[model samples]
Target: MRTYQTLTVETAGRVAIVTFRRADQLNAMNRLMQGEITESFESLSGDASIGAIVVTGEGRGFMAGADIKEYAAQTGPEFDIFQAAGMRMYAAIENNRKPVIAAVNGFALGGGMELVLCCDLVIANQFAKLGLPEIKLGLIPGGGGTQRSVAKLGRSRANFLLMTGAIVPASEFVAAGLVNEIVEVDRLMPRALELAEMIAAEPAAAIEGLKALTAHAVSGDLDDGLTMERDILGELYRSEIGQQRVKEFAGRSTTKAKKGGP
Candidate 1:
């Protein structure tokens, strides 16, 4: 809802779409963009009207990566500050109360791929490419790329991507479970919004609960995750909308039963 120099935020119904506006630079994350990203997602996380969020980029890249020119100019202290801020940016998305989806339009290397790694769902354009190509710059992914990639993709695959710095096609990661779907360039935003809208139609509390539970299942202790899952379910079952939905489903089941429908 606020103006940004590096990105644009707009909403359609209950879904907010954040589009990176640095088309000429392939939407590379500069310091300004990094701060804006953190601000925007943090703002959206508190907005009750927005049920889901979609992130994408303009022109030919979802994000080419961090601006190498900017990175090269950073002093050690400046780089340290930048990295800390970057973590906050990633956390704003990954830990948001609402779901975040990456609509990867093109190249998503280094920090770009790390951005995707933070999202709950990812939909990429057919021609899109993604990798942690920071190794090519004599560096490694400072964002959660290495860890999240290994968690989402598995060790061997993450190693190939991280160690080699190879920018691979979006389809290549589908089997590894990193990508949820791929679509033509024209269909990219539409498909992303469709998924977002589908998610938005659900009870927000239930959706948030599921997001927390799934994140726990991925990285938390099993006993803790099970306890959390049960707690969340119990809470949801007692919620007004949750109770209404359950009753509606039961009513539908009764109608079907009386009509001898399976």
Candidate 2:
């Protein structure tokens, strides 16, 4: 387990739960938090002991956005560094071998929505609000919010929310395909943990390979994607876990046949 000024990480078995600790700011991300989170995920990606990661907010919201006050104070190199850090952090979250799930506990706007977009899965509080409201401030979502919104919600709906800076309730976004599930506030973490546990229960190599293969299929040609899938399938089929499962399946089939014959 590790602790940052803005986040806390605790591993329960194979699932690591990372909680944004700055609830007073609605877990608003600061440059420091961005750097720390990037570091955390980078570390987790290489760690064999941790199979999955869950991100959630404390108090009332997942993350309101970037720390606006801090963002407003940046200039020149500082601003460039901040924005670059955000890009790296978001990419690390999205590309990590271990699955990352966003458990949005409250408000998810602007950078928050961008962060959620990077996640492989999202489970949020039923009453949570999510959007890219950066437009109202005369700035687009510089943290990849604009691109992610379009990718996840499609162009028309993304334009409606991003252009209007509308912050709708979680249910609306769920209907639009951004969120996976919505639960009561009390159920948010439990459900997220449950989902993470399910992912962690799978063989680690297969889980990581599946994520890699799916990501490739998104942008690769069908022939290339099928080639990659076949390669991964061949690799996994020879792995210890895969072989063990195949042996168990054969034993069960033999036992069933013997019982039926006798």
Candidate 3:
């Protein structure tokens, strides 16, 4: 229920919508904003009422990247501390128990794009542009931009983007499997909520298991991944909620058969 200087939180049913409210500065990640983001996700994880969280920016941009002016004035320790905090925000979202969706409504560059890369799912607007333009500023993304970007988009594609600092359309991200879908500007939040709601409809145990197993699957080898998946699948199959849903589904199937439906 608490509000932060850089964020606005609104709950729609079981979904928490966290929007970047720093519109005047194009929602750039400053020290306060990054800490707020990490804290928000940490708090939301403890709220059982909120099943999922959607992160987006206010106004015409998701985030124009970190506030460049602030970055220009940082001393050695200041920059290191800020960078660590920013990484924590990104990691919090990436490793959060709840599913975090990125509803990218505008340009996401540099740190902005890195934030998107850390999210569990991304629903981007058609006109949105995403890139890691840190190289253009005589820097490189220090916040998982190299590793996470490569994990999602593969080495060659991620390499080209990072090397050239190219800002490309959302379509290219979809092609690279980075984005889940593209939507019209007006439909962005609605579609993201639709997906969030659908995910929330499932049993929490099943969803949690999936998130854990998938993370393990991606990070570990195939043999270990398969074993972990098998363990989760078996447990979920025997869970009370799972059995209840199966019974209801069976009843519906039986009724449909009696009615001569497919």
The number of the candidate with the highest lDDT is 1
Candidates 2 and 3 compared by TM-score, better number: 3
TM-score per candidate, chains pooled = 0.99, 0.95, 0.95
lDDT of 3 by residue, 139-256 (tens): 9998889988888898999999999999999888887788999999999999999999998877877887788777776668989888988998899889897889899999999999
Model 3 global lDDT (CA atoms, 0 to 1): 0.90
| Model 1 spans > 4 angstroms off | none
Alpha carbon deviation, residue 31, candidate 1 (Å): 0.5
214-242 in candidate 1: lDDT tens per residue? Answer: 99898899999999989999998998988
- Model 2 Cα lDDT, one tens digit per residue, 142-237: 877777777788889989988899988988877777789989888988999999999999999899998988777655688988898899999889
* Candidate 1 TM-score, C-alpha based: 0.99
RMSD of each candidate?
0.7, 1.9, 1.4
Which candidate, 1 or 2, would have the higher TM-score against the true structure?
A: 1
The residue pairs found clashing in candidate 1 are none
* Winning candidate number (TM-score): 1
RMSD of 1: 0.7
* Candidate 1, residue 164: lDDT: 95
lDDT (0 to 1) per candidate: 0.94, 0.88, 0.90
Determine which window of 10 residues in candidate 3 has minimal summed lDDT: 211-220
Going through the candidates in order, what is the number of backbone clashes in each? 0, 0, 0
